[model samples]
Target: MYTIGQVAKFLGVSRDTLKFYEEKELVKPKQNIENGYRKYNRFDIYDITTVNFYREMDIEIKKIQELRKSKSIEGIKSLVDEKEQEVLKEIEYKKLILKKLQIVKEDCEKIKQFLGKYTVKEMKPLEIRGEIEHYTAYEEYETLKENTDSLKKAVTLTSLRRVIRFNDEGMLEDKFIIVRKVEDFEKDIEGEIVSHPKCMYTVIEDGRWSTGGKNTDHNVEASLRKAAIENGYKLLGLVYINLLLTTYEDGLERVFLEMYVPIK
Candidate 1:
């Protein structure tokens, strides 16, 4: 048997936490009446260490006590399983935090280079009246894809969107193409006005913008036109998109889009 001081020295726990654990009927240490000091045997030491291990793992105190008293392997396994899930969830949360931190660090570097910071404002209604050549040419799709990929292979997508906006006088900015947040727009709107020869066809009200994936543009344009017409308004104008923000693959990267009459 060893005194409380010895146990504290061995395990690096404060004498008080140990006493509290004892008072809570956790680890039953032996007592030496001669010196009125709490004494602990090797068995006590082992039991205390086991309890502390569970505590450090964030196991519930009541659950740990239950595990200690319950000799069933199933009970112990259940506790271990719960702790494993908690640990996995914590790891996922930490990974997300690190990803966000990396994005913030990159943004800071951009500011250092006079790359400019982003801001938001309600867009003033702009007039856009541009003609669309039909026959569904995929040239624009190919060019955007090639450019976007090039941006990724080089300085990354962040630098690419900026370069595209600067060079493509044809590029729209600060505009978000608004799409209804329904799960599926195609099946929802009956007799949707899509697949038309009319180039000037949609208008966006309050909209959210997102990164341009090849598959999304046409559907969103079609959804807006239907939504507008369903709301009793004549959908007039070339399908022009407003990029609410230029975000390169990060959450909190502002995104929204609104369709407007394309302005030449």
Candidate 2:
């Protein structure tokens, strides 16, 4: 048996929350006869602990009360099964956010290279992009040339096509580009993974990763792998080099890629 204060101390919850829980009929504390104070027995402590754990797991208070009302193993199992997908999805989102943060930190380290002269600005909703399709890994270089040739022959893209940085949501499994047009969906796209530019990426400070394209002149994958290892995290997944900006230079079209890794 314990008093309200004692129970709160034992369970590491604020007395106010426990009182609120009682007021909500979530927990019914035993009554004290002499002064009509609240007394929490061992059952109350167990209930509070369970509630705290569920709350930490982001379970809704109303749902917890419903479970308490049903108080059946089958009902509890069914509720848990329904919640499993949501929990997993949230975890995946958190992992991607963390990875993005790490990538941003790395980019900030080499401020001049990544930012150039650009100042900070809020990102608006990404505009629609056009894309070419059916490019193979080996012919990725020639495919880019072909796409450029087509771009020249057709109406020049009035709106510059920029590759938008995308947070992985378990659907982006293939390496592809976001272009100004999608001419061939089945053949030209989803064929080339190595044709695009690659770079070595690493997190420097503030848990963000940035790719330095210095290794572009040499072995691309090896340099990127070295950078990943140097950053104190393993290469758990594929790195996405997003072509955020593009321009033509010296008979070569250069695209600035935002190198990214998904982390958990």
Candidate 3:
């Protein structure tokens, strides 16, 4: 037998914690009848050690109490198995976040290499979902809303399509279509699925006005057209802008994007 303080010191726990276990009926220490002083025996020490083990495994105190009274090995195994599954799920979730962080770091690194540089590359066929703005129906809207989870995890890229056509006023008409590049699957997805082949690729920084206070989309389009012509390539009507990052620099909101235009 040992005094409460002696047991607490040996177990690396506080005397108050030992008292708490006694109050919870987890360890029934012998009490001095005259002075009502607590005395812990070997059995009480063993119970304290077992309770500490269960608490380390994140088992609730009430559940641990029930487990102590129950002599079912299968029941205890089931509880531990549930905790194991929870840990596995947590590990997988953290792994997904780590992968996303790596991809983000890689994308940021590309700003120096690809910004303002033009090259022709063979872009793989992409499966995209979403119609051009103003042409999307109610059913299409609901479909995009329904598969929200897939949009977060499985989608490769979120992009915008701009048609390089002029309106009746001899001005460039802006028609921005929001789309998401998804995994190629045989099962049909909602909205329009688009594909592209070889493209003229470049990275562009937008959202900043020129010194003359003008939108730079026209200048970018002209530059791409010039590059295409000079390289013996033909513009295939539309530009696909894959958004990379939206950030604030020099107190101005700016967008960094990877631009792709199909070529013949």
Q: Name the runs in model 1 displaced over 4 angstroms.
A: 32-36, 115-264
| Predicted structure 3: lDDT | 0.71
How would you encode candidate 3's per-residue C-alpha lDDT over 138-236 as one tens digit per residue?
444453444333323443323445545542243455454555445666465566666667889888887653223357776887788789879998777
State the displacement of the C-alpha of residue 157, model 1, in Å, after optimal TM-score superposition.
21
What is the C-alpha local distance difference test score of each model? 0.49, 0.52, 0.71
| Model 1 lDDT tens row, 86-192 | 89978977785686578667645533442221221122332221111221333333433333213223312221111011112333432211122123333543221
Query: What is the number of backbone collisions in each predicted candidate, taken in the order shown?
Result: 22, 20, 0
For residue 5, model 1's alpha carbon misses the true position, in angstroms, by 0.3
Error of 2 at 217 (Å): 28
lDDT measured at residue 139 in model 3 versus the true structure, 0 to 100: 40
Local accuracy of candidate 2 as per-residue lDDT tens digits, 104-129: 56644544354322122212222233
lDDT of 1 at 258: 28
Runs in model 3 lying further than 4 Å from the true structure: 1-39, 60-66, 69-71, 129-145, 148-193, 207-215
Identify the leading candidate in terms of TM-score. Answer: 3
- Tell me the TM-score of model 3: 0.67
Candidate 2's clash total is 20
Predicted structure 1: lDDT: 0.49
